[model samples]
Target chain A: AQSVTQPDIHITVSEGASLELRCNYSYGATPYLFWYVQSPGQGLQLLLKYFSGDTLVQGIKGFEAEFKRSQSSFNLRKPSVHWSDAAEYFCAVGVWGGSQGNLIFGKGTKLSVKP
Target chain B: DVKVTQSSRYLVKRTGEKVFLECVQDMDHENMFWYRQDPGLGLRLIYFSYDVKMKEKGDIPEGYSVSREKKERFSLILESASTNQTSMYLCASSLNLVQGETQYFGPGTRLLVL
Candidate 1:
């Protein structure tokens, strides 16, 4: 079974400040990791996904994540966050080539950006 | 654009009433899924359909049923709606499982059961 854990429940950051959201996963083999963002009353939007290759993956809205196999982590980062970047973020993991490719998601981290 | 559309953006139903949530995707994907979103819980899968009439239970399938008569449309049904079932329902679709595919989500339906 695959599972994801996000340590931070909520994080507040000032406009133009760098932000990092930690995510850890428990899977047997090399897993596919993804980051998703959701606004209030809206569905989730994929930020980026990691299958293989480059450890540093860039996503939409100037967000990036590094896949660290040693720590079983795929942490999302942004150089400078804007006020509009305030939303809930989720980390998900899935098996490499499983039949039922369903994702197991973390609890989610709510981001608050202050201007 | 791969668009996934959910029939209702907001729904209100009474307890014990039957509720249906419709989802349609234009991408001709082979996999479709229904999930519920809550405050602490990010997104819990309710049901998934790999093909027409081929449904599978997800982590949380109790009190929920699904129908997929056609390839593009997937429906989630609540036999007896309860107050605990009130949540945002999300629909997603993806390509076949052979390739590394990412699921695209719909706008979601907020169901309020009272």
Candidate 2:
């Protein structure tokens, strides 16, 4: 069984400041990771995903995540945070095989951006 | 753009009543999934279907059942609605796992059990 852990429950950042959200996963094989964001009263949107190849994957809204196999982490980062970036972020892991190879998500980290 | 549509945006159902949540995708995705979102719990998968008439239980599938009669539509059924089931239900569609496609989510249906 695979699981994801997001260390931060909530993070507050000022506008134009840099942001980083930590995510770690526990899996046996090469893991497939993803980041998703959700606004209030809305569904989730995929921020980015990492399957293989490049260690760094770029996503929508100027967000990027680096997959580190040694650390078992895929942390989301943005150089400058915007007010619109304030939302709940989730980290997920998916297995490659099986019929119901759906994603297992973290508890989520609420991001607050202050202007 | 791929669109996954849920039948209702907000639903209020009485306890012990049977509840049905419908989801449809236009992208011809082979995989459809049902998930629930709580306050702190991110998203818990209830059920999923890889193809028509084929359904599989996810991590938390005790209180929920699903039906996929057609390729594009997946329905989540709650045999008897409970207060604990009062949460946001989301539907997602994706290509098969071998394709490594990302799941596209619906707008979500918020269910309140009274």
User: How do the residues B1-114 of candidate 2 rate in per-residue lDDT, one tens digit apiece?
Assistant: 999999999999999999999999999999999999998888998988999999888879998899999999999999999999999999999987553568999999999999
Range of the 10 consecutive residues with the lowest summed lDDT in candidate 2 chain A? A94-103
lDDT of 2: 0.92
For residue B45, give model 2's deviation from the true position in Å: 0.7
lDDT of 1 by residue, A1-115 (tens): 5789999999999999999999999998778999999988888899999999999999999999999999999999999999999999999997653455668889999999999
Instruction: For each candidate, report its DockQ versus the true two-chain complex.
Output: 0.59, 0.60
Off by over 4 Å in 2: A97-100
Off by over 4 Å in 1: A96-98
Candidate 2 C-alpha error for residue B48, in Å: 0.3
**CAPRI quality band, candidate 1:** medium
Task: Give per-residue CA lDDT, model 2, range A11-106, as digits (tens).
Answer: 999999999999999999878899999988889999999999999999999999999999999999999999999999999988755544668899
